[model samples]
Target: MNHKAWSIHFIYAGVILLLAGGQMYAVESYQLTPSATKFLAHNVGPGPETAQGAINHFMVNSNTGVRETITPPGWVAWAALSAGAVLSVHGGMLIANKR
Candidate 1:
């Protein structure tokens, strides 16, 4: 194939991603509130600042009742939306550049 063909593919994939990702993110966002609460409840101590540690903390706290008054990452939905938007724009740019 050629650059133009590849660019067209990118643009199409990006549009699909934007639409699907938006819907998925919206649905998932609603279900995340409880998970977020649990995340806050688990991440209270001086646990390792790593993804693995966070998972471990959540698992450990799930077995026990360790509640905390901290804020979890609330920008998850917005961040996902922004990523979809970025992909859309990047694909648009690729199409434009190829044309």
Candidate 2:
């Protein structure tokens, strides 16, 4: 793909990562609303393996709007935030060069 397209992708992905990192840092535990009917079934324990991304999380759904509760490590959250900022700035620079 072109550099412009990659830049745009980077910007979008960075923004999403920044948002996720901010949420992870802001709250100790947050609810993840599920759109799938399968998630409405049972609660998931924090075992070695559960779901793909939910491996390290504890997910419990008891007829509530909440789906998963994630408690990310401090370093992971900071790293994500830093990476997001870097990617976003890099994408902006790429776009500037394209002009």
Candidate 3:
């Protein structure tokens, strides 16, 4: 492969590696403290009672507290945007170099 092709490949690989590393670091550092989830449960309101009910249910039934995993709709949209950007860059490079 040519220098330009190698450069693009390296750049893409570097970005993917960086993202993966950051994600792994985040997961390793993440702590699920009760207060944070409690605050989310309170403000986002499936209602305080419902939130507490979930906590109680988990504690009683599973011997562990509830984990409220909230992913907003915009997250998926942003992921799609990122994927589009990568694909567009790849396509543009490929098409521009076609002989």
Candidate 4:
């Protein structure tokens, strides 16, 4: 309800964003296990991305594993990094002002 409380929430959100951004940036790609991929395909039918002119994300099934082509935009990482930095800095400033 108070400024400090909001600041703490900001800090928490910023930290989570930072962690998520770091993870997204660090891992270029990942694959689901064969069994997991099979399960997913079985439950969720249709792969539009497999066809031409598909605007949505989709996964590829292969012997190795299933890989989803989400977060294809390169700017996502930079956006997350910038947002996290700004949020974290703003939160720290608010906390400092309280003292």
Candidate 5:
């Protein structure tokens, strides 16, 4: 492949790796309290129940045993998606410029 194509490919790969890392971090760092789970179960749809359960389970594992704060996976996912999109655009520009 040409240098431009290679550069674009590298950019895309980097973005994918970043997104994957963020997803892994979010999955490992996820935490939710019992009260938060209860609230989500009552307020949010069933779809979020599993995530809430995971958080609740994590909370139970901690010594504090108190609901502190939680970072939703959606945020991480969105950020990754955004970064990927930006990378794709940058790659596209590089390819276009080479023509």
Candidate 6:
């Protein structure tokens, strides 16, 4: 592997890791806004595992006569997780292919 190729791989890996970390942090800190809740309810469709269902459940489960911290919808978190994983894998592949 040439030095330039190895350096490129390292840069790609670093960028991907940073993006993944930032995405995870954002997902962890995000709250379900009122508009977002409405949007989910309207667009997420049916079923217990659906986005709307997850949002509804999270809301109901979290606030039961007490103030509790709200979290992002399941689908949102899952989307972030999948995106991060894919990016990480691509970065890994870049490093692995460097030669």
Give the runs in model 2 whose Cα sits over 4 Å from its true position: 31-69
Off by over 4 Å in 5: 1-6, 14-72
lDDT of 6 by residue, 18-97 (tens): 57556765665555656555555546556458776776656644534323345655565556555656655665676667
Residue-wise C-alpha lDDT for candidate 5, range 12-61, written one tens digit per residue? 77578677756755574556776675565455553435886666555545
lDDT of 2 by residue, 62-89 (tens): 3444454456778877888999999999
**Best candidate, lDDT:** 2
Predicted candidate 1, C-alpha RMSD: 7.4
lDDT of 4 by residue, 30-92 (tens): 565666656656556555555431322233343545544334355777778778888898999
- The TM-scores, one per candidate, come to 0.40, 0.60, 0.29, 0.62, 0.37, 0.34
For model 6, give the 10-residue run with minimal summed lDDT.
60-69
Ranking by lDDT: 2, 4, 5, 1, 6, 3
Q: Where does model 1 exceed 4 Å of error?
A: 28-80
What TM-score does structure 2 among the candidates reach?
0.60
Cα RMSD to native, each candidate? 7.4, 6.6, 10.0, 5.3, 10.3, 9.2
Residue pairs in steric clash, candidate 5? Answer: 32-55
Cα misplacement distance, residue 21 of candidate 1 (Å) = 2.2
Off by over 4 Å in 4: 33-71
Name the TM-score of candidate 3.
Answer: 0.29
- Cα error, residue 66 of model 3, in Å, equals 18
Q: Assess each prediction's global lDDT (C-alpha) against the native.
A: 0.61, 0.70, 0.55, 0.69, 0.64, 0.58
Question: Best by TM-score, which number?
Answer: 4
Q: Sorted by TM-score, highest first, which candidate order results?
A: 4, 2, 1, 5, 6, 3
Candidate 4 structure lDDT: 0.69
